[model samples]
Target: MGWGGGRVLRDRNVVFYLSGVVVSGFGSSAMSLAAGVWTKSLTGSDSLAALTTFCVWAPILLGPVIGTLADRARRRPLLIWTNLGMAMVLLPLLAVHSSDQIWILFAVLTVYGISSVLLDAAEAALVATVVPETLRGDFNGLRMTANEGMKLVAPLLGALLFVQFGGTAVALLDAVTFVLAAMAFTLIRVSEPAPRPAKAQKWSAQVAEGIRCLRHQPALWRLVLAGAATMGVAGLNGASVYAVVDAGLHRPPAFAGVLYAVQGIGSVVIGLFSGALLRRMPERGFAAAGIMLFALGVALRVVPSAPVVLIASAMIGAGLPCVLIAAMTAVQRETPGDLLGRVAATANTLLFAPNAVALVAGAGLLALVGHDVLLLVAGAAAATAAIGCLLGSGTRAPAAAPALGGSVRVEDGGAEGSETAHDSR
Candidate 1:
């Protein structure tokens, strides 16, 4: 495809970018589901399977330091190399056979987690660089759709593949997707500056700046905090899915894929409408609504019916992405281009680190608490966060808020559109 000089066809960068996301997201989602199943099959421990997800998320703790790497390099090349590196890393997973080799799966997933850190930071920065400001909301919404849409299908495919073949088959498939995604990335072109001068700032200072940047932006800070709360509980909620299936619904482990697909359907629906929602509802309100929906969904899951579980999955699928996409779009709009990488990373660390902790804690706590109890706790927390966001937001509607990347600028006026968010990507 042509990479330059037209309106429709020339938007190849976005196309390539989304295409890569679709392919890689499918593989990643499949592998993520299969890893847990593989672990359960290898060892009868549910906690051990949840640990596989924990390994995949733990690397986000290093996001602040790792995110700076993106700003220090041309984003396009960084993205290309990172995708390729992830592909190479997944190759090691093919060695797993017996339960003893479970460590290999964890190790590979840990590496994948690190790769994800780079990808999120770079991709955020790159989008700011390549996409028109006006189009970000739609692009981000669509990206979420592609990602969650894969979650709907990939998990089933992975589970079936594992049932028929093995974890090695799933691993090989994931590795291939990584390669294909890298190739897709390489085909897109963008104009980027040389790396900022080394003397521009010390590395430690840069990392600190990223955190400080968010602190100074109240809207972004509040949004991110809400997201953190949501994810923190979401981790527990997610950790309960397998239990909900095995103990609550009395379904086999593979049935979890069916629920995931249901959730993906909800996500895709919300993603399609998200752009319009952003226009009517402020990012904060949109996120708050999502939080509430997710909480209610979790609460419904405690009903112990398969149909109710499916409904809960869709509620979760719809709700999680709203908070995520809203927070991400806010970060992109609020931070300066130079600090976008670090700021995005910092936000991710803040938002996702809690998820990692919750996952680990949930895994351990499952020994003591029932899945229904955990779901109740998660729902309460999310509902509380949602209410807090609404009550604290005061009377100002989100529609009155200024567009982040557009002509209307928001100043520190504490409301939207009053401040001009700097962007020199």
Candidate 2:
């Protein structure tokens, strides 16, 4: 498994798919960062600038519904056309010359958000069809590393482009990246199975299948719940970064970027090892360990020293991504191919909704409470989640054998693979 797992990275198709993801993700990150800046410049309103990001995020609320599009259509073609559509959407932004046309930018961002929902769902489904199961953990980890790395670099490039040539140039650059991504997607060659016969069900009923699939899998249910709980607290915890830099460590606000870079470095390193860790540990245990590490990282932030805070930031970065990768890999490994899109989308909504809410409420909550208190609260929440997973490990059921239509069922008292569940205990 290990030898084959490692070699999956060398597969041409996997490389092509990941390459497209990285290129498109980098461009998307740049455009997203510039949206706020462009809005602020055009209207000189901080509120409106903030609204630009919100506009991009708003379509995530429709993930389950939009994800149905992915499952109903062929995933690779869906991805190719989606990227093409987003490229055209960005083209209109090149013509934005005044505040009167600011709405056009917002509209494009909304399209970006909508595209993001479908892309995420489609990618998960497509990867399931193309990538070997043994390599899934590594693939997810590498994808995360790529995304985190982009966050560190893309904003700077976006700012530079916006300053030198204006928002139009940024849009043009983003459009070119999308075209490249489309070309990359087109390069991928996989013998996808014919589409499953359409179920004679209502739209609402189709959507319900996703939720039912998760609920029927006990292991997936526990993993998803743990992630949601962590995200709920992590949202509030994220607000403490600026506070820790500004007030706790007595540093300039810009210092937060340095800390973010440090965190991203940690995330990238841990992501490399995630596949190996998943091989040795149950996804639940890996997720639990990550949450515990994150809790410790949060607790360490109480120290006023800069070095301590930086170390804590790295720990937090490394810790949170473990949970995310574990949950995603579990979904990919366990889900049936035909239902993978909706299930992936539903899982995303479950995992990310709390983060969105927390981000929205983070500023107000920080104002209402002390930074130390918030950190402790976040740590406590995370610790509680980790402990819950630990205590439940011995009692929980194992993953069941794959069921009808190639769906793997995770019931109590069975193992996910040949590995023993007691390894977690």
Candidate 3:
């Protein structure tokens, strides 16, 4: 299956959007790594160090509320300002020094996480508005590639910077990248229609609309339910990495990095091919396949062979992104532009909140169960979720599209005649 990379690249809007994503992803990845190292250096506590990640992800629980902000303005401007605002927000990190001041870093990262969620919603809305249906898959696949590509170098660079110049250097590096990303966003030439005035409703009511949209659609619900289960299991798998190295494979803790490296490679390969695969498969089918593949990989980890563990890591990585891509692509196609921001945010919350919670739950479970047992349970849970999707493939479609002010209309399976509102530059 040939990925339509050429068509995606030929579009300048996609190119600029990908460039911004790559630039920002590098900074974010680097900063994430360095933040942990920085906290450990100052506080000498692994719990506090891990808290950095929690700070970044915990705000996802508020996604439905925060997402409404995206629907209030044009998406391009929202993306630019969010990037620029976060850049300003990150600058405060440069001032942090003593362990007592570590709270500042957490504060900044929390805001960073909010912006990340906001940008995610806005970017999905913008992509749905501007990118062609035929090329959307390729563009999203490349987007995943660019983000994953950053992990290869950013973490090492951040670690080096932390060792050499301290955490402030990494903060500055990330701030610069945010500013650069803002610049890249400015270069995307597309016409955005003004946001429709959402009838005056209570803030909670507006948020509920996003939740309602996701639940009302049969396809979206099944895919999201499966995605939530898979990601939660993934968080469990993440918690098992060290234990697996020590007990399952009888390797040094450092061997964990080798597994991650192999996993990253698998992620990149699948991201490149996701566009082609989605073209031939329904989102639920694609997502279910991914879930099963991921479950098999986790189950195989119990084999205890070094080669087998590494191969399992690759399979896990390849399988993980499949559901994510399918879910977001489905959102882009199935959602009306008016509610895109809030709906995307709601879906993201449903998918990721479980993962965040599972991180804590997995850590606790590890204390009580063997890594092998934990993985087996995780694999079984994920597999069961996939089977539910497979058996429920004939679930009813969503109710007809809403008559909204924006140009987008809900279409079945991204039909060839999918009407998009775009002004070619």
Q: Rate the local accuracy (lDDT) of all candidates.
A: 0.77, 0.77, 0.80
Q: Candidate 1 lDDT, tens digit per residue, 1-425?
A: 11111221235555676778888888988899899999999988998998988788788898899888877887778877877888788888788888898998899888888888878888887776655554455667777777777776887799999999999999899888888887877776544667767666788998888889989887778888889999999889878889999999999998987887788799888877676677566788888999999999988899979988898899998998788878887888767888888889888899888987887788888989999898898899999988776665432243332223333322232211111111100
* Alpha-carbon lDDT of model 2: 0.77
Q: Which candidate is the best by TM-score?
A: 3
Over the stretch 1-425, how does candidate 2's per-residue lDDT look in tens digits?
24223454555555666677677767888888788999999999999999998887788777788778778988878878988988888899978988999999998888888888888888888777655565567678877777787778988989999999999998998898888878877776655666788889998888888879988887787788889888877787777788988889999999998988988888888777787677667788888999999889988887899999999989989998888888888888788988988888888778878877887687788889888888898899999988776665331222321211222222232222110000000
TM-score of each: 0.83, 0.91, 0.92
Which segments of candidate 3 are over 4 A away from where they belong?
394-425
Q: Which is the better candidate, 1 or 2, if ranked by TM-score?
A: 2
Residue pairs with backbone atoms closer than 3 Å in model 3 (clashes) = none
Candidate 3 local lDDT, 1-425, one digit each (tens): 46666656655566667777777888888888999999999999999999999888988888889888988899888888878888888888878999999999999888888888888888888888866654566667777777777887778888988899999999988888888888987877666788888787998998899889888988788888889989999989998999999988889998998998888887888889887777666667778898899999999988889999999999998899888888888888888888888998888888988887887899899999999999999999999988987876533222222212233322232211111111100
C-alpha RMSD between model 2 and the true structure: 6.7
TM-score: the better of candidates 1 and 3:
3
Tell me how candidate 1 scores on lDDT.
0.77
* Candidate 1 Cα outliers beyond 4 Å, as residue runs: 1-10, 36-50, 94-104, 163-165, 242-255, 304-306, 363-374, 391-425
